[model samples]
Target: MERDRGRYVPGGRESAHQADYLELFFDLVLVFALNGLVNRIVPALTTDDLNVRWAALFQTVVLALPLLWLWTTTGHITSRFDPRRRLIQLVVLISALGLLIMGTSLPYAFSGRGLAFALPYVLLQAGRPLLFIFTLPVGDAVRALYLRSAIWFAGSAVLWIGGALTTEWRRVVLWTSAVAVDLIGARLNWPVRGLARLPASAWAVERGRHLPERYQQLLLIALGETVLALGISYTNEPATTETTIGLLTAYLTTVLLWRVYYHRSGEMLGEALDSVRGRNNLGRITGAAHIVMVFGIVATAIGYKLVQQHALDRPFPLWVVVILGGPALFLWGRIRLERVVFDRLSRRRVVAIVALAVLMVPLAFTSALVAAIAASVVLFGVAAADARRSAGRPPEAPAPPA
Candidate 1:
């Protein structure tokens, strides 16, 4: 076994890493999973019942966090390990399968397929680390890290499986608590009373480009969801004038989302990671910011479906929320990303966010198409501002903490 060291896991972060083909394939699974998430929410938004609408909205957060966490954990694994190794490739493939199962079970998760969701999730969360524990050498820092993580997952498994057994709000409570445990445990380095926590070196990036590239791929996946929703909705019926314009509006919004994100901080993220001190902390912050942006993009995709289905019809308050709120959420996330990378917020993003919020007052009374177009206009302003800011200047460099 001593001879096998560095065969699976890298000996150190001695080289810059690029994303592997397997990692990209795993992200493709997320494309389907996120589309399912949007599909689940659209129906609830269309209904007149406020309770069901709000419940679906709550469900969005509940379901999305776990799926995103799976993706995040996978990214971390591939970042730290030699993803080309056969064993690590198996891990990525299995995670993709787990995500597919969870996505398929998502629409019915609160209903009959609760266990289907919980079981795969539990297996992935607990199983991955257990596999690594045996393979990694004794006294390896990563081995201890996995040991602590497995302990945390074991404690959460009870809640996840128990949540599947119960019905109604009980399941919701249990599952939500389970997710909280996983997230909080990771945030705290998966601590155990008797074991040593991860060393500071665990957070350092050997391949600085790898993790950030994975995150960028995630944001692109989210943007792709918006396009998929538009294409699917447009084809469901004839291309009427309203639907045509709605599709265009949604596309424009998607473009702006990509532009706003990548214009400065997003494009410079790799450099930011390479130059920043506390790379681990920055990585966590970067992950969180991308999560928020992805959620916003998902909401916007839901809004696109709503717009296409009822282009001329007056939107419900929740529909209005989806249309305007989505871009606002993305802006907020971009703001956080900006702070970490540039150490400052973009004035354009702040103004765009405020504009979206104020539009909600008028948008609530307008058609869904109108609300979507209005939201797109605000995003366009931000994009245009980005262009103007960078028109003659050189690209911005990351100003992350030393």
Candidate 2:
């Protein structure tokens, strides 16, 4: 494998690097962005106005999907290119700055900062790939892939910028349409009017560990957000018995989420990818799984904050939704990921998902604290099932096709 000047060269396993420090530095900004998202949605769950709450919830998804998409794009860049190169470093640093601006604008995205959010995002999404297109040799397959990607991003930019210039639901519709374009375009391989789809080899990951490591880092980042929110929420309040109990419940829930995540399947993604028969769709499946799990973690953080802020208050329906829904969503994502790794459905997670749904109605009448505990218990059961399955057996090797 000959090294290109700035592009990734497929190399021996020994030559491939682990995730670089700069990549981790970039993820710090993602932490702030995740926090902004959690903060953005908390108010919506607490509000009494049905229309306002529903609108804010829609806004939350509208805002969140793009941010997660941006992160996924960044991961692909590092996976496809040489992250240690100066040009790659510059792309990541600029992205961190863009994320910072996006995070700052989030609280006001629907009100006054739509452009503030849209501008940097558009520049990053549409511009970064254009940069890559010029950097690679004209005949390079990777360059061709990026060419298709840039076309899609450039087309979607119209809607993003248009949404930014508008107001209210108009903005939401345009922005949502823009995200659909970006996401669905990528899913379909970013087809253009005059171009054929890039061959599957064009999407091959040269460095196997890099993409999996980045995904794992993101999972930790999401879990880290939950820990930070729990700690901060606890420090700000009087440590009464109820608050203390709520803190413990939230902390346990966070641990259980982490536990359920890393059990056999999560720990074996790299092996699964290595063993998979085809690589083209593995990254896409894994990326979608992590996105859903991260969403769940962010929502869980918001729910715990609500518990800390109003521990004794009667749980609102929305609060209960957040409380149980987060873990349920996490389990749902985990089940998909398990199939990717093991080629098997996760009955335990399925049962947990159903259990959470059943508990939601009863939990709605209880305190947020009770709802939090029930969610944690459900997660614990999943983790326990994982432990039991692994007991007295050899470590689970990935069964994913090559």
Query: TM-score winner among the candidates?
Result: 1
**10 residues in a row with least lDDT, candidate 1:** 7-16
Give the TM-scores of the predictions, in the order they appear: 0.96, 0.95
Candidate 2 lDDT, 124-185, residue by residue in tens: 99898888777776667777888998898899999999999998789999999999999888
Residues 1-402, candidate 1, lDDT per residue (tens digit)? 123555344333334288888888998899999999998988888888999999999988999999999998888888887677677788899999999999999899999999988899999999999988877777878889999999999999999999999996999999999999998988888888999865633234545588888889999989987898889999996899999999888888898899999987998889888885567787778888999999999989999999999999998888888889999999999999998788886788899888998889888887999999999989988988889878988776678866
Runs with alpha carbons beyond 4 Å of true place in candidate 2: 1-14, 200-204
lDDT of each: 0.87, 0.85
Indicate which candidate wins on lDDT. 1
Question: Model 2, residue 227: what's the lDDT?
Answer: 88
Model 1, residue 377: C-alpha shift (Å): 0.4
